[model samples]
Target: MTQAMSCNEAAGLVRSQGAVVLHTSPTTYDRYVSGPGMCLLDQTTEPAWVRTADSTQCFVGYRCRAIELEIGQ
Candidate 1:
């Protein structure tokens, strides 16, 4: 229900809040974090690339994905 944000704005949220749920689109969202420390024991941090109002491929922060999936890649 909110407007799309800039890369800086999205990156700032992770830096300031440590972890937050970010919505790229009305129906698409994911949990982003400042670092791996914020991820679960069974999860690992991965680069979060998203389209923002100002950039197409913005590196906002990291996303928490399954550790096994990360290793498998």
Candidate 2:
């Protein structure tokens, strides 16, 4: 199983890799991106908050979510 990482580490991965699938818990994971360019045509980039080893809610990078979904939020 993938181990939890720090916010800085996660951010670094996104910066260097452009996109990454980060696992916050054993079953919880999300795809993070360095910028909106990585998102699909129907998706937009939003702040991604996740639990890290050193913080409960860390701002690592951006997450791609459907544009329509974000509009309702």
Candidate 3:
């Protein structure tokens, strides 16, 4: 299931998932394209095996089920 997460939490999740995390923002025309275009903002800060597409415009991680996320109020 998907959930709304803060930037900090997203970073932590990326680290634990053994996935490469990147921060990105689209260029002027890139933002208006039918498909989104992403500009890399930062390089990977942690070790991960996930390969990100060049179009990636946000920091995201991926990995097998190891650590579970705790949800609360």
Q: Which regions in candidate 1 have their CA more than 4 angstroms from the true location?
A: 1-3, 69-73
- Please give, for residues 3-51, the per-residue lDDT of candidate 2 as tens digits: 4677788778888999988877787888999899999999899998787
lDDT of 3 by residue, 1-73 (tens): 0123454454455445433333332321111111111222332122222222332223443322223346972
lDDT of each: 0.82, 0.81, 0.31
The top-ranked prediction according to TM-score is 1
- The candidates, ranked best first by TM-score, are 1, 2, 3
The TM-scores of all predictions, comma-separated, are 0.83, 0.81, 0.24
Q: If the candidates were sorted by their lDDT against the true structure, best first, what order would they fall in? A: 1, 2, 3
Residue 70, model 1: Cα distance from true site in angstroms = 11
Q: On residues 1-73, what C-alpha lDDT tens digit does candidate 1 reach at each position?
A: 1137878887888789999888788898888899999988998888888888888888888998886655557
Candidate of highest lDDT: 1
* lDDT against true structure, model 3: 0.31
Off by over 4 Å in 3: 1-3, 20-73
State the lDDT at 31 in candidate 3.
Answer: 14
Model 2, C-alpha of 45: deviation from truth (Å): 1.0
Winner on lDDT between 1 and 2 is 1
